[model samples]
Target: MQITQKIPPFLERNLGNVLIIAFLAILYIPILLYWYDGWLNKSINIEHEYFSHALIGFPYATYLIFGKNRHQWQKLPNKNHPLGGFLLALGLAFYITGSAELVAISFPIIITGVMLWLKGMPGLRLNGFPLLLILLATPNSIPYLLTPYTLPLQKFIAAMAGFLLQQLRVNSQVDGIYLYVNNIPVEVAPYCAGLKMLFTSLYVSLLLLHWTGKISDRGRVITLLSGALIISTLANIIRNTLLAVFHGNGQHKAFEILHDGWGGDIYSTGMLIVIIGLNWSLDRFEESSMIISDEKDDNFNE
Candidate 1:
């Protein structure tokens, strides 16, 4: 049967969105596939396990975009904002560089511009996090950029773990980034420096702030971020100490389990719960103060 020549009413209303979606799909599909292959290959190697975060970032962003917020997509008005025009042009410029990292950066900028061109600032404010989260997903220069600065963190964690081991009556020594627990040398590699944990925890804290609609409260946001940083740092120190203890005592299976297995996952989940709990406690305190103030106002009126 011949198809009708007429465009559907829905398509008629959303032609611009359809075109933009098609263009983005063309631009990003290959980039995503490349990273997916890298993640798959890296998953088998313990040293490169950080690449696995690339696997979840996009899927989670997609969830945020189309799962909870799907209804808002149709409400945008497609008139280009001046800022959006500039951003779109800039993103297009990056797209021609033939560098995967630049191209990944371009995706978020292009998405930002598209959102602005379609619905302006309000739309961006509503849906910006998912696009921004894509920055963490792609293969980029993040590791290279972060490596030089990671030594300090590595040294610090090594020192802390050594101290913990000594406190636990384990013979330990700390020399630079090497920790000797019962003289079984454990190197605190750059990847073990806790920067990834810190970065990941900070990002998750941002997610909580955005979801809770607490992003506007700068004081609370800063407070929450600071708390996340401290919690993640301590958690990393504890994790490393335990791993060293396990390995020092010749508990190879336990060391491997905690190093990159279910033990690590459980530890991470526990850290996440602590961060969430901090947020919850802060909110409860604020609510209690407000209620107390209300009661004081009622007493003054009486």
Candidate 2:
């Protein structure tokens, strides 16, 4: 008699999913780790820290895919189609080229292909918010694209900070992107032009519009996005003002802590909290206006 083995029922049932997951892990894990290294330890400029915002993207995407939305993912239909096969094939071809840039480019194509192949075209098109999140989170050469604008912003920050310092009775002057605080020249380098903070805030604002269902309200979305941009700009101006005061007035240690240590993180976290508070305030204001409008309509109907 031939020897036989029994497969665990659960394992047998989920074998396809397991295989797909394993294949993805092998294909994507290296790339993901590479990105992780860049985000945390190897920014293009240690001072600018632009790529660090990508650090927020992965965790948030995971939560979107498998947290409260887990059931939605579970309900998707699994199907096999040639379009999916073509995408997968294309993504794989790109991956094997041994070019990091090409691999980065292929990342979303692979995600789309996988979604279509596993969940059908309808699922890919209709229930694809998670895909958009992943795409947004994917770090790119955006910092490079934004480089030219940094000088103008740097000038703005220096001027604004100089004004704030004068209000505080501190003698400050701005020359282009350089601020003379206590007659000590402090340059507002492009690296510390707050590009990362501004970029991250804009991104997080878009995510908020989607998460809070504010995207459906086009006017409110525009207002909120504009608010986010303004808040980021103001926050950066304040941060640089403080830094100018600290560094120009012989508080070098304090300036270093704020610029290169946990102080910076605390300030950034505070900025994000403020943005969230803005979102909450807008929501409450909108609800109150709706309530008043409904009351007016009721009186009209009477």
Q: Model-by-model lDDT, in order? A: 0.80, 0.79
What TM-score, computed on C-alpha atoms, does each candidate reach? 0.83, 0.86
* CA lDDT for candidate 2: 0.79
lDDT (10s digit) by residue, model 1, range 85-144: 899999999999977668868988888888888778877877777877776554556765
Question: Which 10 consecutive residues of model 2 have the lowest summed lDDT?
Answer: 42-51
Clashing pairs in model 1, backbone N/Cα/C closer than 3 A? none
Off by over 4 Å in 1: 1-5, 33-77, 81-98, 116-126, 136-138
Candidate 2 residue lDDT tens string, 238-269: 99999999988999998988887778888988
lDDT, candidate 1, at 124: 80
> Residue 223, candidate 2: how far off, in angstroms?
1.9
